[model samples]
Target chain A: MNQRAAILSLITPAYLWLALTILLPLSAMLYYSFLSDVPIGNREVSWTTENYRTFFEKAFYSELMLRSFKLGAEVTSICLLLGFPCALALAKSIRGRTKEALFLLIILPFWSNALVRIFSWTMVLRGNGILEYSINWLLPGTGPLDLMFTYPAILLGLVHSYLPYMILTCYISIDAIDNQLLEAARSLGAGKLTILFRLIVPLALPGIVAGSFLIFIPVIGSFMEPRLLGGRNGTFIGTIIEDQFTAVFNWPLGAALSFIMMGLVLLILFGFSPLVRRLK
Target chain B: MANVSVLNLSKNFGTTTALDRVSFQFEDGKFFALLGPSGSGKTTLLRMIAGFESPDQGSIHIGGKVVDHIPVEKRDIGMVFQNYALFPNMNVQANVGFGLRVRGISGSEMKRLVAEALELVRLSGFDNRQPDQLSGGQRQRVALARAIVTKPRVLLLDEPLSALDRTLRLEMEIELKRIQRDVGITTIFVTHDQEEALTMSDQIGILNEGQLVQHGSPVDIYENPQSVFVARFLGEANLLRGQADGKNVKLEIGGTVKTLSKPAYPQVICSIRPEKISIQKEQEVHRSNGNRVAGRVNEHIFNGTSLTYLVQCGNLVVKVFVQNLSGEVIPPNSSVHLFFRPEDTLVFPDA
Candidate 1:
């Protein structure tokens, strides 16, 4: 028919699916967050702000939220530090079939199940496990080096799960950079570190920021890795929210906590939007 | 500013030789051009001089100092890439000041130097504009400013003007020459365009198949080309293979062409430039110092300023250029006499 009709028809299906799947569920959660109790199973519920009030009134929820943010920051920073060099090597130094093979290996983790990967880490990290046996084999009778059920174990697992995102994004950015620019910088008397910090890193900042967003947002809300790798030490805001919905059946509190976490994330993203704009 | 010299520099990429024992001296305060076709190893030679590519068989000396072991960063050279290669993240000022900043020159000194460089390239008010925002010519100016801000010992340019449009390229040719003269840096650039090398360089070195075929001033190389390849490459040349005796070449087309210089070998090729041959409708005057050939005009290709007439003489077609004066053209199929001086007929030994 007309151009407007044509455009609407093209976009209608995808938007319709998103509205039904995401927008409707989110609206239901918002309504549940204001209720005093669950609105099902013959429980008399009234609309109230008590569930949200409990989150502010208690220090437990804020502390767990801060701890989750800390964990996200640590994992994201570690991923950037490790992944950027690997990406630089893959994009700049390595070539041809080797680079392609390395790239395949980087994303190979995604082919297997995430739960299986976390469980496999537990087998290597537990007391007197593969890691301990290898260490003691190197230095005999060095005692049981147990890292299981610790915060480090959870950090390690999350980093392992998310590092590929950082590398792939950074590779795209670094690869797009012209080699002539590097040579020009060197001819202008820029040494290795200067070229890296000034030319290469700044040019690749968009990728670094994108990778952080990809890893950080999901990491703060991650529940499985911590639960499997970290015993009691893995109790984050994610675990508390999981307990609220699945164990305690406090749907209202869980909805309120999820909304609060989302608000904080939006604030953080909004604060750094200028940096992203500058990259563009 | 210092003279740069490469002594027998050679480079091989796998099995193919990119540069083969190519050696030349680029005099200080002069503009030198490495002219060649694609894959002729001119770019490879420039890179060797710039310390980007190392030679397999020789050493490079800049200002009489052997810099084979010196790294590119410490070479103290300035290079402008073909695509400008300006840092997209920084503005013009930052890009120009990067070299100085890396050398630990900051504050007012760095700013003043960067400003002077931008002014030299006529990009004074463009300090805050990013590279992508600038036009092709403007980005080129920024690249030039960035290259020379630190007052490098030698300047290397890799086809710096090939990215610009034709009119812009012509303008930049003069602009680049003036900037080089003003800075007085020993500058060397690689180009495949013969006109660019002829118009811009103080000395031109022609490369063929990774070897230095001929090198001299523009006029020397154009007037007295030592080889057939050099004679054809610099400009349009009408090559006629024939038997030579003393100063006359008996053409295969049943004519004898006289030359001022005798052929070194019995068999030689006579090279005559298109512009050197004059066309006459009536053959009446013989100056006794020139060679003449009778031909019929086959075709006339006309431009605004000049006309190229493809004249067919027997079994050969000879090209002759005439100035487009009086708005007249010798019609095709007209019998004409092509006249050129004996000295204009360059004789080269055919191998």
Candidate 2:
């Protein structure tokens, strides 16, 4: 009985910490989502469904939600398409210290803050940035091109930011594939393309799916890239939520938008559950 | 069926020579076992034949056509790997039908051929079972069935039964021999197990240090091994280190022992099989042969049907196998006399 009591005492601190830090905040957010904004003095209290009702009633909010999902999906698809081949090359073609160096290069961007990376992209895509300058220099006849505050710039930033995640995940998966299976396929009259498609790709599906989700979830609520590179027309749901809290001083509405984002993430998680189970 | 000829085959990886100027001919419809220890270039030779590997400085001819430049898919050969190499996602039927499908065979003909191949391996109704669902022996049979389903002219097997248990290995060996006989395809089997090679191969080629030491029929290899490596590798043999002079040889053990038969070389190492040495009581002996040796029993090991006695004469220890007939037992530390006919001994050049 004394040992059991001691063991329980030992486990109580971590359990309490998790409850206070994670579970408590999530439950508070859930409760705050139901509260309505007070009319005056930028305050909100009491229970009402007006915040969710307003979001559902407004076409702008719905469009923002759709645009967020579209961007996330596009970023995930592009990352998967580009990252898988890069990872395969890294895992199979490179060797020794060269392979290690390539892996480090893929992961090097993740060490810096995402805001700084997005700011760098903004500097490059601006009207008189290096890209426009280089284009003007190379073409000579063409004038400076305006690339800032564009969808492509935001998409480019998002893809560049999350590509490392996809590549690393894919590398782990491709590296785990048995070389014997490829040799076996080759010996069994399978050509190089057949071996890659049938043996290498199918075995690396789990990694690809995992990397897709890792990049998609974060890109869905991305704020930095859209704010810096997208400018006025590049506003995302995360930026709107940030404006409600910091500029508008509507904590309840901000919490409500955050809850909606969490719900969207949950929907993605639910949609991917069956795929993950099937892969396993 | 086609004959495979490897001429001056040499493969070098960096500084290590995997196969050095190896050349051999596998006759049509002949079951040849490339018997050797590990790292003896047996599997390399098999892979070169399968076209999975390209020899550094040689040409491979199959059916009088140079196939060194041909890819593995165009080689038109079947291969069974050591691990069975069955695709985990595919069933036995799909695996067996893969070659046919690759060759554009479909419909009832493919199904019938796959069925026939499965039936040849005695696995008729196991079509839907995946490789993971089958036992080790079943998987091996599936590999064999897959290899033969295409009716390839040459079949390459790389230690097909090495992963199986002893009983399963024995059963598969018999099955393999029966299948080879039935199909009548030129087959090359690679294995490190000497007993397996001796039991199943019509011809065994012994390889050592990337070179073919000896190639002959099983009887020829077992009865008369040409080199010291072959004699030591095939089975247990008593190596009598001696200097040959005319019809008499001087042994390191005792005085010169006269040979009833002469060797081709003046100095040679005589190899005598353990079973060739016969032990008898000194009082029961009627006649003495020139090849007979006097020794005392140092140790005796009972091996179910026979008793193996280690006889020590001076510094030489020779093993002799005696059948345990009439419920006779040979005790260790006993005085015994061993004898062997001169014709039973084989002499090779001393290395």
Candidate 3:
């Protein structure tokens, strides 16, 4: 009984903090999602389901959501493809002080402000930017490659922002794998590709799944990078939601849209949960 | 099956030489053990043979072919690590059939071969069980099965039984020998456990400080160890420093020691195993053409089946092992006579 009391006392503060921060706001959002209008400054309001109906009935909202999900998938795939090899090199090829230094470099972007990082990408990606200048300098006769405010620019910023997550997760799992297993495979006549797919990839699947979830969920719900980097091509479900709250002052629509996106994300996660458990 | 031979194999990691100029022939279809303590380069030699680590100065020949530049997979050898190294992601059957599958052998042939290999290791009908589900001994068996399934030219085991418990280790020793004999593959096993090496291998090579100190059969290595390191490493040895003349040596402790073989140097150290020396109460009559010494019993240890008495002869405390057939215990401070045959005494240079 004393042990139980001690555990309860230790956890109660954290639980209360989470309730205040997450649960209370979520409850307010749910209530606001059902209202006809913003319940602020003594404005008259009524409980309604029109905000949710707007999301399902309109083709525009669903298309934007699909586009947002596509962007998330593309970013996740690119991150995984680029990050897994870096992680393997970091965890296996390099060793000692070099590995630690490389690891620090991989996570260095996280130390800087995300907004600053995104804006820095814009400066590098604009028409007369360092990338175009370098290409023109190398080729001696290249056109102005104005890559700013494009879909690729948003992808570049997001991948840079989230690549470390994939690499770190993969490095952790791959590093935990014993070198003896690889040697054993080689001794049993397994070639390089065989070792990678049969041994390393399967053993590192948990990290791949985890990294994918970490990158995908936030990218789909992201508004800042798409707005700053994508410009005219930046219209996504997240931007529409942002307009509903800050620009249009339609809190009910924003709340409903946030809940719908949460539901879809939860559904996607639920669909892949069985695969993750099997990997474990 | 192929005989593996290394010719003056040498390797150095930074300033420390991991393996010196070592050369040995591991006979085909025989179980050979590389026995040594830590930092003795036993594992490094094994890795060189397995093609995991290349030797810097020597060539490794498998089946009379110099395989110095061959990659590990192309070398066609199977190895079992100390940790077993079974793929945790694979089930028993998948793990066992990995080599065969990688070699493009599938369908009923793969199934039959995997089954036969598993049955050889005595882990049959465990097709779907994952590696984490098995015990340590069982995982080792699975690793063995996986290694031999592809019928590689040689099988290398790196201290595979050291991870098991005492009783399990003993059982696996016999089991491993049986499997090796049944498969009749050229096997090189590396281990630090002298007892395990002595019990299982057909040939034993003792190493110390990156050099091969001695290589012989188990009985021969035990009976004739050339240096003090091998004499003490393989088993306990009692050394007596003395001045030698031919097969006889005048001891500093006021007794004469004899050896069947003459010593080359005037100064010699005679080694005698504890069990070879017989102890009797000083009052008993003794008649034998052997070296005899009188000592006071310092202490005796009762080990259920045998008794070891620490006898103080002059300034030396000689250990003698006696069978506990009569259940007799010798009290401390009693006078005793220790007798050892001249043939049982081994002579080495004093250096």
Candidate 4:
């Protein structure tokens, strides 16, 4: 075969799979979103903008969507705050087998099934669970220490689930930076704080931005953790979307809500991309 | 600009010694080059001076203050890294002005000084250009400008020009020397390139195997290297193993070669630089004052400026370079005498 035919033959299978799996479902969802009702079992289904109009008209759906986005922003902030220093330590201070071991431990959560991991957090964070039990055992009459199904518990779970993504991206970026740059800064009479503010943060901005988006995008769409760990308080945009499909059986409304959520995520990502490019 | 000195400085990397009781003084406003082969601890010494590494047992003094416990930032030194570690996100102006800005000098004053430094390195209008936009040589200039903009007491360059091509290296070398002279900041440059050290430094300190083997002006070190390592490392040397007499070594190549220094040992190593040894068809009466070795030319290498003859004598091949002024290329297998003045021969212990 000639070059063009050979290239087409090699790429056709993957492209076909993507079209069948992702593109087809997305198109179906867009169509389903505009219908007045389900087209099934001889029910009269008519085209209408009612499903989308309900979204703009109702405060509940818009509130849940905003709440879901707020959760993403909070979790991503905590992850960056905690994980950046950990990554810097791994990249700059630790070395040899020790660094390898710590790095493996950080990403260990990613190797396991995410659902299993979410289930496991309930064992630790639930009322009278390991943390509460351990605390009461240490300090006799400190009470039940009820922390499960709270906002903080949900935040903690999300951060725990995604901290590794932040760390890995940051470690790669920090590791690529030449140690000489830091030394050069010091030799030029820059204190440690100045070096961090002036030299290190700007250089690692791209990594921080990438890691933030990776963690934020998934956390926004996540339903499993909110259901298993958060209980009633986890009823955010994601859980509401799940309700539209399974509980209410309103696939059209779910599709409209999903599209709106996707638009907000895209808007946020575009806002941060210019800053990333500028730093680079 | 102030004098810097280290006394009995030493550094060890676990099982291996990187620098051992090394000590030297760099005078104010003097350009010093620490010359050595790779892994000779030249860069290690330079880092210690820059306060990047603390010597296990030594005291460093800058100007007149002991700065043994001082951190690199507090020590007020400037370093140019081998790779020219300019801030990648920062433009040339920001990089140069970093030292001054961190010192709390801001606004137009900082801008003026940075501009002055850029002009000094001959990078006047490159202030807005990021480090990525510059070529290898231009980046090198930015690095130099950044280093000296703070009027650092001492400028430490760690093989800053090794990344450039030959022509660029030479150009940067001349440019660096001119900048160093103009600033009059005490400067110490570390390099494994001997020609660089020879041409740019007021004083050259040679290091070998974690030890300071010799330190002197370039002329003194080049003409009178005290050890086998220094003699060979500073420039090429044809070493002949021999037994020492009062002022000469009885060569292993079946001849007596004259020496400049009296050897304390019975056996010695005699080193003579290639260019110092002149090749002649036969020894003339006036040339009898110098030591002589007879050999057949194994091969002749010709360039427009110089000619090199690989002469085989006894069991060894010795290289000799002569200026191409005569415009006559010597043929291979021709018998010739290798002549050198007795004072040009260097004697060292046979270890």
Per-candidate DockQ vs. reference: 0.86, 0.54, 0.90, 0.90
Q: Kindly report the docking quality category of candidate 1.
A: high
Model 3 — TM-score against the truth? 0.98
The docking category that best describes candidate 2 is: medium
Candidate 2 TM-score to native: 0.92
Q: What are the models' TM-scores?
A: 0.96, 0.92, 0.98, 0.96
What is the lDDT, from 0 to 100, of the residue B330 in candidate 4? 70
Fraction of native Cα-Cα interface contacts (under 8 Å, chains A and B) also present in model 3: 0.94
TM-score-based ranking: 3, 1, 4, 2
In terms of TM-score, the best-performing candidate is 3
Model 2 off-target regions past 4 Å? A1-20, A37-44, B258-267
Tens-place lDDT per residue, model 4, B1-351, is 899999998899998899999888899999999988888899999998988888998889999899988989998888999999999988999999999999999999999999999899888999899888999999999999999988889999999999999999999999999999998999999999999999999999989889999999999998888788888888899999999877668999978977787877998988999999999875332466689998889999898899989999899999999999889877888778889988888888898
Q: Write the per-residue lDDT of candidate 2 for residues B31-110, one digit (tens) a residue.
A: 99999989888989999999878999989999989998999887888888888888776788888887787778988999
lDDT of 3: 0.93
Off by over 4 Å in 3: B245-247
- Candidate 1 residue pairs in clash (backbone atoms < 3 Å): none
Give lDDT tens digits, candidate 2, residues A7-85: 9999999999999999998887777778776345665467888888878898898799889989999999999889988
**Per-residue alpha-carbon lDDT of candidate 1 for residues B1-351, written as tens digits (9 for 90 to 100):** 999989998899999999888889999999999999999999998888788889899999999999998999999999999999999889999999999999999999999999899999998889889888999999999999999999999999999999999999999999999999999999998999999999999999999999999999999999989888999999999988889865688988767888868877898888999999998885444444578888899999989899999999888899998998778888899888888988899888888
